[model samples]
Target chain A: MTTTSTKGQRLPQTSKRSAKAAASDKRPDEDASAGARRRQIMQEAARLFGTRGFEATTIRDIAAATGILGGSIYYHFASKEDIFVAVHGAGMEKITQAVLAAIEGVEDPWDRLEAAAVAHCNDLLGSSEVPVIVSPYYSESLKGLRETLVAQRDRYETVVADLVEALDLPPDVDRSLFRLNFLGALNWMPTWYRPSARLSPADIGRQLVQGLRPR
Target chain B: MTTTSTKGQRLPQTSKRSAKAAASDKRPDEDASAGARRRQIMQEAARLFGTRGFEATTIRDIAAATGILGGSIYYHFASKEDIFVAVHGAGMEKITQAVLAAIEGVEDPWDRLEAAAVAHCNDLLGSSEVPVIVSPYYSESLKGLRETLVAQRDRYETVVADLVEALDLPPDVDRSLFRLNFLGALNWMPTWYRPSARLSPADIGRQLVQGLRPR
Candidate 1:
């Protein structure tokens, strides 16, 4: 009964408890291996799901890609949607952590905002799965799973909202849309972004954040 | 003909001309009817294709949506992909015209930029198909279509680049990336934008453009 209800948890609180339950059900060594197996399946599944349409990628494809048996894949994930949610939740967690860590100890509101953008830009540029898995969360195929996916995504919003609040933008400025404009430009990076592009993510992030200052 | 050729053209150029040719080979009214039918099918197909997955949308489904006989759809569109290209191309042309009209005769670069953003935002908010059809241009199902889709998309980039070039940013500003940040933020509106978001699209667009000013 010590477990907290996670209906509103933005982070993956359930994963830890689920792991603990599995640990108690199995030997410690088996528990470690199962966790690793689940992770491996997710990475491969994300690749296939990202490259191949999610509907097109069958359970056997995910299993074969990760070198696991199809029947055993079910032991880790109940269904394909469950795997997608896990992969998506994990990706959101990764970037959120990166952004939060980057702004750590930054005292200036503007500087903190810039730092958060830079961290986010780098993560989007560096991670293959970050954009691929996250972009499809809005698609029709994920209509049933949107609530769960959106909650994970909203966790990142709290960080940006805090940054915007600290900016103390003028009342005339619509702060919510300001935050959205800042984020939209950042997320749109995956569309035209190429490694050959001359500007580093930090430089771009700074330019975007600079737009929020009083004209 | 001095007219530049569109690389990877998916639909017949000058549907009237093609229809006329078909008419000469068939009957007199065929030319006008062919052109009108082509437009009608593309409009309804776009509606369905925008809401439904492109691959998942069958020719029969398109015919049913448009109230055209199943076999006649082939007369207007050689294949499903051809219809897709036509709808996508038409959508791009519509928005391009809107933005161009907005920026026309505006001497001040900043004024031009804001006007352009406002027009774009209004169009995206007002049009149902703008976000839906344009998004699929980036999907894996369109791998064979990427060259054509990207070329059409790049046509819009020239407009943004010209605006950015007029701004005459400091030598330190990465103009290409600066352009991307502006466009990305603007393009991202479709993801989170809602009628109740408390800010009009024009208001948000103006705010985004104002970010271009130096601190």
Candidate 2:
């Protein structure tokens, strides 16, 4: 498990398709500014998706929020779905990095899980933009996009799964369900978490792990 | 706590406005079939909302699904949002009823909570239509409807809260977060749960509770 742990590791891996697309089909003028503009579009689109949901949000809305003309957005991404994929990918990267950094020096398995949880909670509940879009409710209409989002999400999930596998639990415990329930608790926080709440994200994360820790 | 238990007690309370409108504004001819037609609209709309999301789904889709003309849907609902409210209200009533019945005569607080969780899991993950719509990802655009949905959701939440309050846990436990985490785990199931999974809904519910039960 320690060998597999993502601690102190800089994971530069993006999804293969996106990498290939960037290499082959992207415009020749791609530069630092173009990269920044793409990020800007994703950030603005993430905000809208968080507020209005994927379907209700439009390319026009993203362009307007980013202060670019709607047609200009097509220059960066093929469609709204493409923008969503980018935002989702960015969000997954953000949280995955957060979790990896938090668990870097933690040796104990349960403690590592707790650290990851704290980092996850902070990233998810601390901000209103990227993480929210990362876990948007997957309605059937988004079926075509769901596979891509879930695959991206699974990269982060594998880190958590490895941590759960390292825990010293009773043989009867189902580790898969354990990991799912642990994540469900953390991910579900945004629905009820308030910034003013006395429990900071770290506190919430610790409490969650404490509740589930084997006696 | 049992005194406040909703067990065996029928909760007929719907939101005030809906009840009032159902009485005053509804036509006198709202006979058995009219009531059935209204339910049909809600069921179809719930399915669409589950598959297509609230923003993407339209009255036309609901009408088409219900085998009624789009304009005639106005007779059953004033707007798509109205249909959403109806479906959500109906879903709340459904899970509430399932939970209330489940905890009935279960005396131990933990056992009662487990019972409620089992019932909740069954209802939420068992079917595709109602419970799915009940917890739609609330975006900023849905701010006007959030209060109503949250209020309706709270009626069921109170039951869980009361159950949590009855638990004999460490003094340090934040019961509010405890309840939130517990409900979050259960509610998040629909995102990843598959009917083919080896764990039955009952098994999943029991497992969730067992994981949290204090040693």
Candidate 3:
């Protein structure tokens, strides 16, 4: 019933396996500029990964996209998996912050849920990174990255869990199932949504609430 | 906002590029047994494609899995993409039949929608093939298969469109968006649903109704 309400298997709670090169391991001079540069690298890498998929995409491809040399790209991260991990983290952070901001100060649980759904759909539609984190379709092929991604997902789902907990529903309703179904719909948006389409993300979000809300 | 509600780009409506070997072109001798063999091949291929991606899965892998030699696979399927299209067709047929059967006697829009939703979730959770057609996450890389797949998707979405069309809702409610959100949630079950979990497909389906139904 938790965010980990998965079919028997799930992502790791905490993977100590370092996907990144430590400051002590590779760079002793890591600082604010380094952090910002890492963010920039992650943004482009996430986009390419989303577009090209995991296997077809290469570190060299990411480097070219970022206008940096392939070898230099590794200086920011240990490997392709490392960059993916960072992208995963960045995508989760972006969507999470957006959802959190949307739901803030909304007293009604349904309203908050709708707002969260809207923010989520809008973010996924607007940002490639959010969809990357949401689907992780490519990650299935990358076994080493699975645990790290799952751990990050658990963090993201906790935010959703809190929102679901706020809903005032019948005592008999299964809250876990509610959240699962709710999120499945929310996450599946990237596959079908279009800006040219009639429904905006917010409109779609509200309709979800209307469709699900008891008549 | 119909089933073709895609993100700017989508598959072709009618691909004159036939995936199947035409009667005059190659398989003129195809009989009932050949038809059964094609079905068997598609079932096994769909499962393999679902587990390993289309790119990673080879024709030989499918042939071995089906207990046939690699060369024999082509007797029924022209290529891997051909097998994929057939699987897509079969998966669609199975779910469509199940959903059509479930909603046959149902009349009320709310009840019919719930029936369709339950049938869909059950179909998805019960059959590995259903999820194959539903997500086809690997299709992103197969540029040639994209249009064909999208066309198949349009067919599937039509069923959903019919169900949404029957719904009695407010004028302000965007029916297309409602169904899109509803379907998004329904289609996402396979990623997390476990038989060992508490909710049965029908139970989960009912919960979707309860969550979405107006209070």
- Best-fitting candidate, measured by DockQ? 2
Tens digit of per-residue lDDT, candidate 2, span A1-215: 11122222322332223433444544745644555677788889888776667787887888889988676666667667888888888788889999999999999998999999999998988864455454535756478987899998999999999999999888878999999998888888888888999889999999999888877
lDDT to native, each model: 0.73, 0.78, 0.70
User: Comparing 1 and 2 by TM-score, which wins?
Assistant: 2
* TM-score of candidate 2 on Cα atoms, chains taken together: 0.85
Which sections of candidate 1 miss by over 4 Å? Answer: A1-26, A128-132, A211-215, B1-33, B47-52, B69-71, B128-132
TM-score of each: 0.82, 0.85, 0.79
User: What are the DockQ scores of the candidates, in order?
Assistant: 0.38, 0.45, 0.39
> Residue A60 in model 3: shift from native, Å?
3.7
Candidate 1 vs 2: which has more lDDT: 2
What value does the lDDT take at residue A196 in candidate 3?
Answer: 89
Over A100-154, each residue of candidate 1 has an lDDT whose tens digit, in order, gives 9999999999999989999988887765543436452254667898899889889
Candidate 3 similarity to native, TM-score: 0.79
Off by over 4 Å in 2: A1-30, A132-136, B1-30, B132-136
True contacts kept of each: 0.51, 0.55, 0.53
Instruction: State the lDDT of candidate 1 residue by residue for B1-215, as single tens digits.
Output: 12222333434444324333656655558566776677778877876665555655677878887787676776566677877777777677777888899999999988999999998888877654433255522556778988887777778889889888998577766778788878877777877888887778888788777656544
**Alpha carbon lDDT at B79, candidate 1:** 74
Docking class of 1: acceptable
* Candidates in order: C-alpha RMSD to true structure: 8.0, 10.6, 9.6
